[model samples]
Target: MAGREATNPGDSAILVAERLTRVLPGEVPVTLVQDASVRIGRGEFVIIRGPSGSGKSSLLYLLGLLDRPTSGRLLLEGEDTGTFDEDRLATTRLAKLGFVFQFHFLLAEFTALDNVQMPMRRLGRLDEAAQRDRAAQLLRDLGLAGHEHKRPSQLSGGQRQRVAIARALANDPVLILADEPTGALDTKSSANVHDILHDLTRERGCSVVAVTHDMAFAQGADRLIELVDGRIVS
Candidate 1:
């Protein structure tokens, strides 16, 4: 994979991980990520790719602040997150980061519009009407315009994923972390999701970091980080 590198991957980065590592304690402790360092710039589409158990998703979780690193540091938009408490971390995640998983994870019972509104409601940045407007616009932008009232079960696989993307964008996050976002879709649907995410960087000025096994998806990224046994490989 070939793509442009940031002129200054650190000073101007949207997300930076330095010597990040994660370990799970048990009878025999397991290390999921080891000494990883990387920087993602604004509007960059980055792909984290490796074989199974290479810690792709683990690294994403660490970057997204969903899990703490056993050691090392993460900086979001040049702010060090090492000292942030759980509540602060949650707040930061909700405000500055968005996530899309392989599973759409849309609430089956909720309409697509309601699902997108959930994040904005939690963030409380907008009133109910404003939230509804934004959610509707996001869905429309993702080609789900008239489908907003439909439940996840009523939509196609691709439409459901688009709804998931809209939900991820509800809070207007600067960094979007996607873990196997297209893993469950067919070829055409996968391409659609791929184009939407890649377009986000250029069109919306949002950074995207996706963990994927699909080389086709990674090929379109602005940068690629390959991992082997939890370590980034040159």
Candidate 2:
């Protein structure tokens, strides 16, 4: 795991999913995703596009470790996830995976800065001063400097979304998984979120895999994966 490209940590793709299939139990068991395979290189911008109920969010959840796949294998930084126990999987996710959902899941009672710092706090990796500094820097970078002290309800829609983005980045994850991140925003706000994600990949070299129905946003990605009824049709 030193210098060889195959073994080197930096040379490994941040995410790889091979033949991933997920099935959920309904009155009739429904397979939500089938034989989906993807490899996301570090710093690459990848998009998953589909219509409503097309299994886009399910794919994101599997990749983000929010839900385990019913079949297939997923690797994070070349480490196989299928064998990990729940505790270990959670630890790996906290260390390497970041997630943003359609809703801005910020804590209503915490200030923006505190909300951004929550992950670090949960991980117990930073001192108070360092946590504040890191959270503040991420908030500022996401253009939420003045709103740092405000609670989620106190900020505008766009500002709240930016704060959510900042919170996702606070842990310095190698891969970011977003599910309909711009779904609730107006055109301008949606564009701003897109710009922020674009800049993140370019400037910070963070790999982003996003699920969206917006064709315009999908067009900006390095790769577009179109899912139809749980399979990649294109």
Listed per candidate, the RMSD to the true structure in angstroms reads 3.3, 5.1
What lDDT tens digits, residue by residue, belong to model 2 across residues 22-114? 999889999888888877888888898888888989988988988899888899888899999999988887877788888899999999999
Q: Across residues 114-150, which tens digit of lDDT does each residue of candidate 1 receive?
A: 9999999999999999999999999999999899999
Q: What does candidate 2 score on TM?
A: 0.93
Q: Would you estimate the TM-scores of all the predictions?
A: 0.95, 0.93
Give the poorly placed runs of model 2, Cα more than 4 Å off. Answer: 1-12
Candidate 2 lDDT trough over 10 residues, lowest sum: 1-10
C-alpha lDDT values of all predictions: 0.90, 0.85
Question: Which candidate achieves the best TM-score against the true structure?
Answer: 1
The alpha-carbon lDDT assigned to residue 92 of candidate 2 equals 80
Evaluate residue 185 in candidate 1 and report its C-alpha lDDT on the 0 to 100 scale. 97
lDDT of 1: 0.90
